[model samples]
Target chain A: MALRVGVVGGGQLARMMIAPAVELGVELRVLAEAEGMAASAAATAVGDYRDAETVVAFARDVDVLTFDHEHVPQEVLAALVDAGIPVRPGPGPLRFAQDKLAMRARLAELGMPQPDWAAVAGADDLGAFLAAHGGRAVVKTPRGGYDGKGVRVVRDPDDAADWFEAAQGAPLLVEELVDFSRELAQQVARRPSGQMRAYPVVETVQRDGVCAEVIAPAPHGGDRLSAVAASIGTAIAEGLDVTGMLAVEMFETTDERLLVNELAMRPHNSGHWSQEGAVTSQFEQHLRAVLDLPLGTAEPVAPWTVMVNILGGPEVGDIDGRFAGVMSEHPSAKIHTYGKASRPGRKVGHVNVSGFDLDDVAYEARAAASHFD
Target chain B: MALRVGVVGGGQLARMMIAPAVELGVELRVLAEAEGMAASAAATAVGDYRDAETVVAFARDVDVLTFDHEHVPQEVLAALVDAGIPVRPGPGPLRFAQDKLAMRARLAELGMPQPDWAAVAGADDLGAFLAAHGGRAVVKTPRGGYDGKGVRVVRDPDDAADWFEAAQGAPLLVEELVDFSRELAQQVARRPSGQMRAYPVVETVQRDGVCAEVIAPAPHGGDRLSAVAASIGTAIAEGLDVTGMLAVEMFETTDERLLVNELAMRPHNSGHWSQEGAVTSQFEQHLRAVLDLPLGTAEPVAPWTVMVNILGGPEVGDIDGRFAGVMSEHPSAKIHTYGKASRPGRKVGHVNVSGFDLDDVAYEARAAASHFD
Candidate 1:
């Protein structure tokens, strides 16, 4: 019998996993949120992730369970564990990604470089954190936040009055606004047997808190910075006993120091560049890690690999028709489109261009992606 | 709606297409021969390819129809065309791949390089051809032969008595065995609009007439021979009006001449290295060409890429257990399993390794594949 992997989330992450699973001779079954989710292309069971009954039933047949997103409730995860299902990035480590407050506390305990943070229960607590942190702070709800949602920057506690009300007494996380020069993302994969591998640190450009483009190997990234990023990624994966992919988003301070910004226990948008850039893609690496197989090499095939995301514009239209023109314009560009309905400001696809020349690859990637707009 | 592709066979060629299909956002529906064929991972319709109704029904839901192999009867293919369904490498071109006699005749008509050949009906005819051609010839059934089946080298007319009896007067293709130094394969993709691209010619090693390993950019292959191979591919694709991928298997004579051996109208074993070696994979290129989308670049990513097939040995056990050790030992090796049940001498999977040194890449690929044995 083939190894059956159950992924809980029907987004592009799971959709991408389908290819690797097929190549590995593993059967992939996805628990999607809806009928037409991106992962509907695979063997999927549609249901709400929060329902323990639905989740447990979905996990019944698979030999192991992993996730495409960190949104599954701990209660449902715990139930699967109780049923003796092998869940990668088990509930223990997934907790750190589920709650911002928990992640901050853990990073602080590990003596990792991070901005000053505090858990705030109300406006008074928020005021105190702001006053202590240069009169401004980044406030975020501890749970259910993603893609720039459930997050706010405030100069005064009064500016977060709506968030405080919406939290309904739940503790919110507040951190000092990071004064960084640029953003970098490091991806690492770990097997249950403790095997680990880290990809080259890449500079990620964000627009409205969403990843816009990624330049792999981070141009101008000295050996020291790359080493520091690699060490940090390795530390987090080992410390958390992560059994799959872990993405550490960091801020490279002007002082040449790195600060942890956020943690994702699953494949992140930043690692998408590895699809064509590296010998083994993050999607394939995640499957290897989850199945307790040795990790594949993370070596970049080219000197530079540039990735540009295709965001859905304000207009509603099909992206399929643009394939001919984009391919004709840049024959070497690798395009990966998610089978999703285009919505305003949504991520629908990405373009990857790899070559020896960084500037040429970056320009091609960006230019090809812009046409899809 | 996405462009739907319906493939006639459920073999590994169609199975490998699942990966590129996901990235292209193209829906692939395969008419598998059985319930658990390799391509069951996709949207499959289990039915007989010989049944015109079943094939037409499967074609109804797809935008274009293609084949994993050329075994589909000519009548069934004609039915699809008569029904207004687009079939890549349309019936006219596919006929060449289906019958050796037809292919040899067509190549001769085009003034292409080929060995001396003749069509024999029985022992008397075979004796005449053998006597005329050094008293030795390679005899083969004209239709429905693959791998090393239904082909034999005979020195006497009575040597193929059993085959002649079984054939019952059916014509057999007879040809003089050419003295060759090595075998080479060139793959090319063409779209309905006439756009074409050819991949680098590669040297192929055969074991019992089955492709065992392939080395891209055939070693010692000078620019002249490479140019000749490319032109031959282009000519065949254009002259035959073949759409999608066409693989031309050729023999390089000891005197340094290229002669046509066989033709395959879909992604063939010789092009498997393109998955990691080239900017665009044959599987992806085939989809784009068949869909009438502009084809992607066929540029090689690495200087040398070696591919070794993993044939099932004399063992009934699963090869999955060996994956961990193989991956750990060769972290850079790319493995592709077909998800088929293991049977002695069956082709279950393949391994690909790419690097600057041809010898090193070839060794690694062979070493990793042997572990599965």
Candidate 2:
């Protein structure tokens, strides 16, 4: 029988996995939230992931269960585990990704480098955190937060008064504002058998808190930086017991120190460049990992690879309308779309370009992506 | 609406197209001959491709029609075109692929070099050809033949007596067997607008008339040979007014001449290496060509890429049973499996490896494929 993998959530991540699953001859079934989602092609069950019965039913026929996002409630995950469903990045590890407060606390226990953080229950607690961090801090909701949502910068406790009230005594996460030169992301894949592979660290360019571009191996990263990033990524995957793909977003300080900024227990935007740049793409690796197959090599196929996302897509028409123009001008650029409608700030698609010259690859990727604007 | 492509057969070629179609956000629908075919994941219609009514119904929702193999009947194709559906590699060009005798005659008319051949009506005609060509020749049924079927080498005219009796006065195709040192295949993609891109010619190793291995760019092929191969491929595609992908199988004789041997008007086994080796895979290029979109570059991603077919899978179990061992042993080899039952001589999967060293790539690909045996 072909290995069957059940994925919860039908976002672009789930859509991207369909390609590798088809190539690997694995049967992938998605539990999309609704019809017409990006991953509708593979979605077999449509229901809320929060309902234990719905998730348990979705996992019945699959050999293992994984995620498109880390938002499946712990209660629903517990039910699946009780039913003997093998969930990669089990609830124990997923809690950290779903809640920033838990992730910070766990990283502290693991001795990973990260900014100072506190769980603030009220204005008094928030005031203390702000005052201790140059009177500036980042406040966040511990649950259901993604992209730039549920996050805010605060100079005064009043900046997050609404969040404090909404928390209703549940502590909100607040962290010291990080002063960094740039952002970087390190990706690692780990099989249930404990085998692991790390991709090179990539420099990410974000606009309005959304990833705009990424450069594989991070130009000028040097041996030490690459090694450090990989080591940190490996350490996190092991420490968190991440069984599928893990992405660690970090801040490169002015002093060259790497501090954890965020964690994704699934394929992240930073590694999208690997689709054409690396020997084994993250999507393929994730499938292998979830199925407990031996991990593949994560070596880069070229010296450089650049990825630029097509945010919002074309204003007046679908992304498909721009294919002729973009494809004509950039023959080597690999364009990937999510089958989603255009909405301002939405990640509709991306273009990846790989070659020996970093400048040319980056320019080509950006130019090809610009057509969707 | 996404660009919908209707493939007329449910085979491995159509199965491989699923990956690129999903990645490109193009909708691919296949008309399978039966339920649970290799391309069942995308098989939206299960019907006979030879039936004009069945094929025309399948083409109703798609923007353009193409093939997984060159076996669709001309009447079915004519029906689709008559209904205003776009059929790539239209009936005019597909007849050459459907009938070897027609292809030979057309190539001869175009002044292309090929083995000395003739349409023999009886034993007398066959005897004369054999007597003039070292008392040996090859006879083919000219239709419904693939992978050694319907073809035979003959030293005596009576060796094909049964075939001649079955022909019922219809001429059989007979050719002088050319003593060749190696076999090669060239692939070219042309859009409906006439723009074309040619991939590097590759060397193919055939076992029992079935493709066993392929080496991209044909190691030891000088610039002259590559140019000649590309030119021939381009000429065949343009001369036939073929749209989409075209594969031209050729023989490199001991005296240094490239002679056309066979023609395939869809993604062929010879170009499978391009799935990982080239900047644009033939399946993706075929889709773009049929849609009349600008074609992507066909440059090789590495110095060499070797592909080895996995025939008949395992003796006891399915191909999935061997994945762990093969993956652990050859982490860099890309394994692609077609969801099909194991049968002797049946192509169940393939392995692709690409690198700077041709020897290493070939060794890795062969080693990985051997695990299936």
Candidate 3:
């Protein structure tokens, strides 16, 4: 019998896992939230992941349990563990990833460089944050925010009051709005056997609160910055005892300070470039880590790889026909389309282009990605 | 809204199409013949391929229709074409592949080389075939046979009558058992627009009537043999007006004659190595051909790529444990498992290993593939 893997959510991450799991001869089952989600490896049971019964039933027959997202409730994870089911990147590490305040605090405790932050309860806490950050700060909710949601820029104390009300009484983390030079991400993986590997830092471009494009090996290929990012990624894997792939989102301040922005405990949107960009894809690495197998090489397949997200724009026309045209133009460009309906601002798919030259590849990747839009 | 591709069968060739269909941003759907079959790309509808209503329903939403095997009933294919649905490598070419005698007749009409063959109804036909070749002949059913099935060696004409009784009512294609030095397979892809390209001729090794391994860029790099095979493949593609990938199985006789052995109209078992062995995988090439898209590169990624089939043997009792062990042993060998149940002599999957040295890589690939067996 194959090792049964129960993924907690159903989306492209689960869908992408289908290929690698099939390649590695592992049968993957999913507790997909929807009837026709991705991850078509084995039979799927549709149910709510937060419901402990649903999760427990899904885990009961599987050899090991992993997740598609970090949103599963702590009670469900605890129940699975109590019942002797194996859950990778267990509840302890997941909690830190689930809550931004906790993640930042944990990183600070480990002597990692990060922007000065404060845990806030309400409007009163906003005043304390602004006073310490030159009358301006970035306020974010501790949980359930992604792609720039549940976040706000507060220039005045009066502005902070609206965000506090909008948060709906959720805990907030306020940080200094540093003058950052660029945004970068360090993608890493750690196995249960304590083996860890890190990829080069990637320079990221953000557009309207979502990742627009990523240039792997970063621009100019800064040796010092790459080393620091690698150390930070490795440190988090050891410090938090994370098992499976972990990606640390970072902001490079003008003064060369690498502030830890977010921690994702699975293959992230940032690592999508590695599909054809690297020798060992992040999806394959995730499987190896969770299964406690020896990690494959992480060398880049090409000198440069540029990934551009296919954000759904304001259009109701045929996206498929447009994609055909893009493929006709650049037959070598690799495109991954999620079986998703197009909605304005939604992440429909992504295109990655690789070449000996970065500028050439980035242009082709960005053009193809936005062609449908 | 991607182009929906409906494959008529649910075997590993259809399973391999999942990867390239995903990479190329096309929707690939399969009408699998059985449950738990490995076609993991798009939605699969399980039903009878021979039933018109069942097959029609599977073809309902698909833009282009193709096959996982060439054995779809002629009446069923004609009905689909009558309904104006596009079937790549359409019924015309499929007929030659479906029946060996018809294929040989067509090849003979085209002045193609072949071992002495005769269409026989009974012992009388076998008598004529054997009298010309030392009173020994090989008999085969004209249709529905592959990998040594429906084929037999007969040394006497009287024995042929008993063999005919054994075949029930199937017609026979008898050939003189020629002295063959090696076997070669030429994989080629043709677009509906008449574009075509061929990969290097690959030498295949069969053990116990099953393809055990394939050595790409066949040893000694026989340019003459390569050219003859490519010419024959292209001739067959154009002569039959094939609109998708075609793999022409050939036997290189001791006299240097390349004789047609069998034919497959889809991305076949022989071309599975092209997934990582060639620049563009056979799956991707098949998709382009069916869709009439421009052909991609067909160059080898490395100097040598050896693909070894995994045929389950008695030692397959602990398949999962063996797979894990093989992965740790050869990290570079690329193994593709079809997520299928393994019985004795069943093709579970194949492992492809590519490197600078053919001998070492071929051994490594075969070892990794056979480890589970």
State which candidate has the highest TM-score: 2
Runs off by more than 4 Å, candidate 2 = none
Q: Which residues of candidate 1, in runs, are more than 4 Å off?
A: none
> Candidate 3's residue-wise lDDT over A182-296, tens digit each?
8999999898889888987898899887998999978865788889999999999889999988999999988888988888999888899888777578988888788887776
Which 10 successive residues of model 2 chain B have the least lDDT summed? B312-321
True contacts kept of each: 0.94, 0.77, 0.33
lDDT of candidate 2 over A302-368, digit per residue (tens): 8899999999987687456689888999999999999988888899999999998988999999999
Candidate 1's displacement at residue A179, Å, is 1.7
lDDT of 3 at B342: 78
Could you give candidate 1's per-residue lDDT for residues A1-373 as a string of tens digits?
A: 7888999999999999998889988899999999988999884699999999999999998988999899889999999999999999999899999988988888888888998889888889989988888898999888888889988999988888888888888888998898899999999999999989999999999999899999998999988888999999999898888889999999998888999999999888999999989999999999999989899999899999999999983265645667877899999999998888888689988999999998899999998998878
Top model number, lDDT: 2
Per-residue alpha-carbon lDDT of candidate 3 for residues B1-373, written as tens digits (9 for 90 to 100): 5677889888888888877776565778899988878764344789999998788878988889999888888999998998888999899899999988899899899988888898887877778778989998888878788877877889988766866787686668898887899888999999888989898889888886678888897887477877889999999899988888999888988877889888889887778888877757899889888988777667776778899898864334677667667777876777788777877788888888877798899888978876767
Residue B254's lDDT within candidate 3 is: 84
Clashing residue pairs found in predicted model 1: none
- TM for every model, in the order presented, reads 0.98, 0.99, 0.89
Model-by-model lDDT, in order?
A: 0.91, 0.93, 0.83
Better-scoring candidate (lDDT), 1 or 3: 1
